[model samples]
Target: MLNHYRIMLVLCSSVLTLVGCTNEKAFERTQVEGVVTLDGAPVEQGVITFIPAGKGATAGANIESGKFVIPKEKGPSPGDYRVEIDSSVPTGNKILDTDGETMVDEYANAIPPKFNRLTELKVTLKNGNNQHLFDLEKE
Candidate 1:
């Protein structure tokens, strides 16, 4: 009976070892750069974020001069990503002034919520240099 128990234990251990072996590769990231334009014009100011589908880290870059560059060291692993952009026009409508006033506030975001707060953009990143361009419309 003792021998029988030992054999069962060994079999179970071997099965567990084999089950742990998988062929999936580790997360791999590559450099990426892109331009963001709105209504045929370059975005003035905003941020672009790449949220991975899963099993990878999120990446983001500031939009400066209508362009953004994500370095390889700071970019997400190669995979599908959900893109989000937040754009705004400089010197937006002034309102809500300081000194407890309800005027002179400047928070004018041209892009709609569907593109930023509720984005619907998707992209597939491969294992090499990538350049993506986003053309957005205001609603």
Candidate 2:
């Protein structure tokens, strides 16, 4: 019957549309690791972030003893990225807590603004494992 043929055609068209929509390829990831040092000494503790220069996901990792690792499963896609490093140190001053219940030691960013807020560091990631070392200076 004509109605039966029309129903079959509609079902086939719907199935083809769904299949076409699901065929997008996934983005590839690369493993990234690195060390951070300041004034020839290892940065004791810090955080590092990688922001894509164009279009991609941003990734970050915790720095412990100047070392950080971003596994492939959670790494960023290969591309250009701007690097930001942040670390904090006690300022030797006491400040009232936000709750005004107690005093807490004041802390300030140990790394220079050029390394974090207004970063100038950049890296180009490839399609495999990558290792980079960033040695920062005081001046």
Candidate 3:
């Protein structure tokens, strides 16, 4: 009976230590960078958000000169990531002519004008300095 108790205690301790090690490795922060290009041209003046694969912390960067560099944050768990843009423009009443100021179609909707669909780019971030370039196409 004493031998059985010792075996059980050892197994429980080993399992707990393994779980803690895995969690620490997962939540570690890392640097990530990338560029966004549309039709072979770098996208300028846009926000690129990185929504992680699961409940991981999100990160992003602002596009400049067709390039972007994400700040050091918690790295992803090595998987696919869906990319979306908050591409919305405000329609002001400061119109020049009636023809130019008309909301003919669904332009009045609150939905932002999507330059590209969500999930257009699937970025895979690893454990080191991650460099990626996304090229978009018209559907």
Pick by TM-score: which candidate is best? 2
- For candidate 1, write residues 1-139 as lDDT tens digits: 9999999999999999999998677557788899999988998778999998877878899999789999998888888988989875646567666776677647667788878778888899988899999988775
Query: Which stretches of model 3 miss by more than 4 angstroms?
Result: 1-26, 74-78, 86-117
> How big is the positional error of residue 131 in model 1, measured in Å on the Cα after superposition?
0.7
Order of candidates by TM-score, top first? 2, 1, 3
C-alpha lDDT of all candidate models, in order: 0.85, 0.92, 0.61
User: Can you tell me which runs of candidate 2 are displaced by over 4 Å?
Assistant: 1-26
Q: Estimate, for each residue in 10-90, the C-alpha lDDT of model 3 and write its tens digit.
A: 999999988876445455555667777766767655767777766565666667766777656544444456665432334
The reply for model 1, stretches above 4 Å from the true place, is: 1-27, 90-104
How high is the lDDT of residue 21 in model 1? 98
Q: Supply candidate 1's per-residue lDDT for 31.
A: 82
Clashing pairs in 2: none
Single out the weakest 10-residue window by summed lDDT for candidate 2.
20-29
Candidates sorted by lDDT, best first = 2, 1, 3
- The global Cα lDDT (0 to 1) of model 3 is 0.61
Q: TM-score of model 3 relative to the true fold?
A: 0.55
TM-score of each: 0.69, 0.81, 0.55
